[model samples]
Each structure stands twice: as C-alpha cells, then as structure tokens.
Target chain A: MDDPRPTSGPVPPRRPSGRLEESKGPLVEPSAGASASGPHEQPGLGHLLANCEGQELQPGLHAALEVCRPNTADLDDPALAEVQAALAADAGLRRRLASLQQFDQALVAALRDVRAPAGLEDRLLKAVSALAHSEGVEPLVEVEAALLAPSSDAASASCVPPASAEADHAACRDEAGYTSVRSGCLAPDTVLPSKRRAMRLSSRPMVLAASLVLVVGAGLVIWQYRRPASLPTPQQLANEATGQFQQDLSEGDGMPASKKWPAQVPASFPQLRLPQGTKWRTCRLVNVSAVMFDVTQAGVKGALYVVRAREVARGAQVPNTPSRVVFTQGVSRTMWRQGDYLCVLIVEGDEQALRRLLRPVPPVT
Target chain B: MVQDKPQDGIAELVARYHRELFAYAYRLTGRAADAEDLTQQTFLAACAAYHSLRDARCARGWLYAILRSQYLKQFSRARRLVINEDPTELEQIPEELPYEPDFDQELLQQALDRLPAEFKVVVLMFYFEGCSYKEIAEQLKLPPGTVMSRLARAKQRLRDALLHTGQPAFNGSMEAGVPQVVREGTPHVGG
Candidate 1:
C-alpha cells in the first residue's frame, strides 16, 4: 500500500514578494508557467497567482471570497462587489474560493458537533438564581423583620389594658370574642357560648404576656443564629494561598521582575525556614502586597502567604503561635503572626506534616 | 410570570446561549471545569447588570463580551507571567490527522489552541459566533485593520494546519486532485 500522507518537509522561505513559495513535494504544485521569481525580476503572473492561491488577497477580498454564492447583502459590500466581479471574470480564482469555502464549512461543521457538557443549562440557571437571590431588593434580615412585625403588634395590643375602665374592658373582650368566632378558632357546640366567652376574657391578658415573652425569645434566637460566620477561615486562607501558588506553577511563565518582592524586604516580614530536601521555587506579591512563597519538599508542594497587619482591616487578630486547622482529609493549615505580618502555611499531608513544617520557624526579632 | 421580570430574563438568556458561551469558553481555556466556571460567571455578571441593558437584541453579544472580560480578569495573573515569544516562527505540527469522514473536532481544536490568544479570540468571534469584523474590533477595542489582519493570519494558519495534519481528505481519499463539493447555501462571510 502506498503511504498516502503528505511527505514531511521544512516550510519554504518567503520570496522577496512576501509570499511563501511552494516547496518541491506533494504539499502544493505551481500550475503551468508558474515558477519562482529571480532576485532582480518582479514576480510574474504565475507567481502572483500562486501567491493568491492561499496567502495574500486584497484587504477585504479574503473575507469576500468566503461567500460561495454572493447574496444581495454580500453584493452590497463594495469590497465584496469588487472581489465577486473578479471571481466572475476568473475561473481559477473561483475554484480556489470554492475550495477555501469548503474547508471553512468542514471546520465549522466539525466544531458544531462538539456540544457543551450535559446539565450546563441547569447549572447556569442555578447560578443565575443564586446571583438574583444575592442581589434581591428585600434582604433576608429585612424580610424576617417585616414578617415578625404584625405578630409583635398583636402581642403588644393584648398586653395593654383598655384605658376607658370596666366598660371599655367589656367592649375589648366582645371584639376579641367576635374575632375568635369569625376566625373559626372558637367552634360552636363545643362549649356553652357564655362559658367560652368567660374563659377567653380571663385568659386574654396571660396569653398576651406569654406571647410577648415568646416573640422576644424567638427574635433573640434568630438573631443569634443568623449572624454572619467569620469569613476566610484559616483553612480557607490556606487554600487560597495554595491555589494561587499552584496556578502560578502550572502556567510555567517566568515571573516578571516587577511582580517579585522588593529587594530590601520590609523589616517586619517573617522569615520562613523550609524542611530539609525542600527548595524555594519562587515568591510573588499578590492581592495588593501580600507576599507568597512556593515551596516544594520531597515532591510535596506547599505555599506560605504573608500579609502586613496594617494592610488588613482594623482589629484583625493574628495568633502568636502556629495554630493548626484541618481543611479536609490529608490537608492542614498552620497560621501565626510574626512582627507585623500575618503568615499562613499550607501543607498537603496530615497535621503532623504541617506541624513539622511549622516547628522550625523562630519568633520575629 | 417569571419570564416577565427583568431579572428572570437572565435565565432565559442563559437557557438560550449557555452552550455557545460554554463552547467559546472551553475553546479559550481548553479546560472543561474552567469553561464551566467562566460560563457561570458570565451569566452571573449578566444577571447583576441585566437591569442596565436597554436593548434585548444586544444580549447575546453582551453576554459574550462579559465572558471575554471575565476570562481576562481570571487569567490576568497567568497571562502576565507569560514570556513573549517571537511570532514569526511556526511550530512543527503533526502531519497526519485521524482520517475520518466526520471531521475530528479534537484535531481542529488542537490547531485552534495553538494560535495566539489575540488571534484565537478574533477567529472564535468571527467564525463561530458570526461577529462582524467591526463588531469584533469594537468588542476587543482594536482597530478594524488590525482585526482584518489578525483574522487573515488566523485563517491562513488554520488552513496550513489542516493541510499539515492531513485533513480536508474526503471519503478516505488523500490524493491532491480529489475534488470536494461546496455545500449549498454557503454562509455569508461577515466583514
């Protein structure tokens, strides 16, 4: 069987006319009378035609040539009109255009077959819904407050006695009894109407007092439960640091000098002592001056992030010693403050590995 | 009722264009998870800014513009770390692509991935998304002439790549003289 593949060869150098000349192979063949131009001679028609084969066309002519059959809109384009007129006059150019169009269609058709992963629509919907919820007009806290208002009002009303004396009390009791009956809370035939009325009038004040206590207690509980959790937990901070480190490593692009830490580091910067057999890969400043170092030990990767205390919010506290936090199975973070910088160390193995890494660092001088 | 709300319009937009946006994202990032994240982030940004959109017809392009912007922001760090390479030298590519009647999407994708980010994005916008040169130039904040030049370079590179990879072979015929018929109703190549 004959080997059908095009023979491998180096790309031919560009001719003085800035067009790539076809090399001697199955890649491309110059038509009749088409040959390479000499150094002193201007390119001939065959050379120009060969150049037009694929490389260079008039400014917008390449785009125009893509239209297999020009329509009214396509014809409306002055450049397309010129190119189409040229194509109408030349059969060779038309064939070349047809070939290019076929190739373009084939590529487009192939790409169209590569569908997006399944459930992407559902994932997008869920994401959009989450976005909307975060940006909604009524916040969760405010909505809960509005819902609690009416109940609170009813409780407060039942607590205060009517100001107009015994006659007003009787009217208030009558109104409450009427409301209860209308709401179907007080059913007929379950008790004598007079006895039910007497019981309601007696218990109304106590019910109001109890409701006030219950509402206040519930409000306190909700307030306690709904308070925002402390964000950027030690583990989360470590993950962020490691994530940035890993991303930089995988990108494989040499870091620019400007992104590197200052030659004369801040006096308060922490000093890190890596374990034996580990070497420091690189250090970079991230998120407006937080310095991070990429370290690898025995093929295990880790990151150390240090940010100045003054750069963070006021009242931010950093522990004096390495405090460990487990992010998940086999991953642990150790964090502490040395001088003015809050330092975090993240390791991929167990807590002992993290402890070992953190054990050697001396206190800030 | 949900569809009537301005916010809910975002859901409709996602439903309609998520696949296209994801494909574009996947092409740019070359990772499925990154593509998914980029797609999700684009829709989220669109939802947040949906109220500012005055024209519904512009939503498709708007979403794409947002995705491009988000991808840039997310990868700006990695991009900054990239050392500039000379553009004139063409890398050696494989000469024999898998011979299949149905074009190998993966081979084509690999070829596209080899293009510089600037050229790759313009090609994706122009060819895949049907963006006009002017529209792409405006979206990318580039001159129209520059867009044209980049697009031409990109197409030539792709053609060269396909040729080197042994594509454009119809019905197992690898010979040079095999004539391939152009499909009826060829698409209007946008300027």
Candidate 2:
C-alpha cells in the first residue's frame, strides 16, 4: 500500500518548533515577520539519532526542548523514551540537557523562595493603611470582642466619657427613625421586612413538640456551660444526680411534667425608665418544680410591660404549642408607654385578679 | 466606592504591585513606554473597580484581569495608530548589556523577540513559567489539544533552525573540534 505522507524509520530527529510559549506556532511568524532571507536559507539541526536493540533514539534539537524536557511530566511515555535515547546519541544534547537541568533547578529554587519582593511587605502594609484611611473601613475588633464576651445585664459602674461626634451621631440617629420617646405615644415603625423572611421563620414549630427533647437539650447546655465538659468524675456524677432529685418530682410520662424553657424569652423592656406614667405591680411567682418557676407581672394601672436586658438572642425555630395564660402570685407585669412587651394571660376568674394584685417585683441589687 | 477620605493611604498597593506589573506589562506590550502606561492604567483600574472585589484575597487575580483588559484596549489603539506606518518596533530591545551573551542565545532571543506579539507571550509563559498545556490553555483561553500541537510544532521549528545553520561550533555547540554526533564507524575504546 502507498500513502501520501512520507514514511518513517529513524527519521532525523526534528524539533517541531522553537517556541517555549503556548502562543500559536512561530514558524510562519519568522518567515513573514522576522527573517528577511526566509526559513530555508539555512539548514536546521532537525534531529539526532542512535540505534540500540532495533530501537533508535531520536532527540530533537531546538529551543522547543525548553518546554518539553526536564520538568515536563512524561505524558507520552514511549515518545519520551525515544527522545531520551535520541538525546543520548548526541554528546551535545547530553551537555545541553545537563545545562537545562541546572536552569530548571534554579527556577525551582526561585519559585520556592517566592517572597513579596524587597520592601513588598512594607508596601503592602502601607497600602492597607492608605486604604483604611481612604475608605474608613471599620476595624472589626469591637464587633468581634462583643461577640466573644457574654452579654452583661448588670449596669456599667464606670463614669461615662464625654460625648464626641460619635455620641452626637447616635443621638441624631435615635431621633431619626420611628423610635418614640413617649409611652404609647407613637405608632409602630417598619421594624421587620418582606413576607419571605416571615414565612421561612414559620417552619420551627414542628421541631419543638416534645417537652422531653427540649428539657434534655436545656439540661445538657446548662451542664456544659456551668461546668467544663470533661468526663465527670464518679463522685461528680453522683452529686449531680442527687441535686436533680427535686426536679424529678415533676416527672410525667415521657415528657417531664416540669415547665422549663430554653433561650430567654424576648420581652419589651425599659429603654428609659419605662415611661413614668406606667404603673407596675407584682403579678405572682411559684415554683412548679425545682427546675421551673412561673411568674406573672401586672402593669401599674397605666403602665405597660417594659423589661430590659443587656443582650438578646435572635429567635430560631421551635415547636408549636397552645398558648395559655395563668393567673399566679408574685409575678408582676409592668406597664410601658409604647411598644410590645411579653404578655402571658393565664387562667381566668378570681385567681386571675388575685394574681395581678400579688405580682412580685424584680429583686433589688 | 470612593467615599471621601484621605488620599495617601491607598498609595501602598500602588507601590507593591506597581513595578512588577510594569514588568508584566512590558512583556505584554513588547515596549517599555507602553508597559509604563499600562502599569499606571492598572492602578487606576484597581481604584475604579475596588468595590466590585468581594474577596481581598483575590486582589492579584483581579489586578491581572484589569491589566489584561488594559492591554487589549491599548493594543487595539496601537494597531489603529500603526496601520499605515512601518514603524520598526526594534527599539523595544535593551540598548546595552554588561557582558555579551553567546551569539546563539542572542540569535534565539532575536528570533523570539521578532515573533508576533501573540506568539511571544505563549512562549514566555511556557518556557519561563513552565505552565502545563492545560494551564496555558486556561490562561490563554484556548483548547488544550491546540496547546500540545503548538508546542510540538514549536520544537520542530527550533530543530530545523539548528540543523539548517550547519556550523558545528555555531550550531548549538561551542567546543571546537568536537564532533556532536557519533559517526557509524567510531573507535570503541582506548586500545
């Protein structure tokens, strides 16, 4: 059979191209753009060959070796074998290969030692400083610090610093929104947004159905927080089990009959002395068990419920449950001039009226 | 994006990536002056597009992208300006050197420098960076198969170049009187 293309039998080693770059081939570029006399004017060192074991080595001769030799992973293993054999055929190829190896070694060393050039670190720092100055990017330090520390409900005893522009800014911002200064004097502002967010939050009720599950979760978190979670000593375990005896008194089926809850309830609290016009009175307080206490607060004749804490946790998913208000002794709901506060209206009748009258005050410091 | 603030702070990224970007731009434009212009243009582009960058860690890639666009824009303008002019771009070569490199290396460099702008970067990236065919493809946005074929062909051109020259000493060898190839009938030993 005859073929149009030429035959091959240890043909002279040929370097297909001298380019080390991935750009389109440079052969035509030399002829049309650079070489005045043209490509064929001088013969090329196309290939080097050596025969051994009926297999001939054919090492190519060109700068193309820069890209193909040394570091190039041998993808075409057989072809590379031929290349290596052919390379050995020429004493010059062997020498050049050695030189190329050195070059490669140097390159590897350089790459390994890559550094932000001389003064690069300083320059980078300077850039950061300049960007900070120009952009006024707030350092996240304060936010991060606040996140790490437990929120303190106790009032600060330290003297307040003189108000600066930041303080003035806060004051201006306080008045800028729908925030009201008087009790029941202002309409509710747009506090929340779009229907989508509300819908997403509605999925939690399914998870909260089992009182046992909630109680166990609360107990585990308390155990972990109040004490290190290292393996408890036998004595410690016995002590804990003994301490929980009073709580076990309210046991009811799979669900503990106790009324323990997790994650503090969000209650509208005194932003500023819960407007003086508001009245406050003790509703009631009673221990349902060692672990659970129930309390209700009654607002003074005119006041609204306003309780304040230093921090609040964002709400998350929980199970749905029926809401029932119980009239009890010692818990007092305070009255406020504005905004929603927690209201748990319990069982009605004479017990409810008496519960409002018996509401207890928050313990004084 | 450019909220009013002190101007001196941001001058750091300028100092850090600026000079290196200039060198990269030089390689890109094949001329020093245009490289400098590209460098300055990159900083401006960085300033203009700073807000769009979400990850500060990506600043290098982002800067490179900006430089690339700047190169393309400038290159187009250059093509338009040079349309009727046969301006020799040889001045892009450095004027002097402390020690003369070998003539072969010089010839190779000359041949490489003379290549069209498109081919030069491919060669630089391949040889200097030792990028893989796939990596080259990704950087140049070309197919990998094309990269392999192009590299093979590039080697062939070099082979032809060295073989055609025919000067034993000049044809990729410097030791005089030393034959590069083993002749068929050579003395096997020191008998």
Give the 10-residue window scoring lowest on summed lDDT in candidate 1 chain A.
A180-189
Task: Point out the worst 10-residue segment of candidate 1 chain B by lDDT.
Answer: B89-98
lDDT of each: 0.48, 0.32
Q: In candidate 1, what are the lDDT values of residues A45-86, reduced to their tens digit?
A: 222233333333455565444432211133345545676576
**Top TM-score model:** 1
Pairs of residues at least 3 apart in sequence or in different chains that clash in candidate 1: none
Off by over 4 Å in 1: A1-72, A79-85, A135-365, B1-6, B76-101, B166-191
Across A21-80, the per-residue lDDT of candidate 2 in tens digits comes to 211221102212113433233121111111112332223322233445343443244434
Q: What's the lDDT for residue B152 in model 1? A: 63
Give one digit per residue, the lDDT tens place, for model 1 in B1-191. 22446458987877667766766776676555666676776666666555545456556555666676666555433432221232321111112222122333344566666776667777776666555555455556567667766776676676566555554322222322334422233221111
Q: Could you give the TM-score of chain B for each candidate, in order?
A: 0.71, 0.54
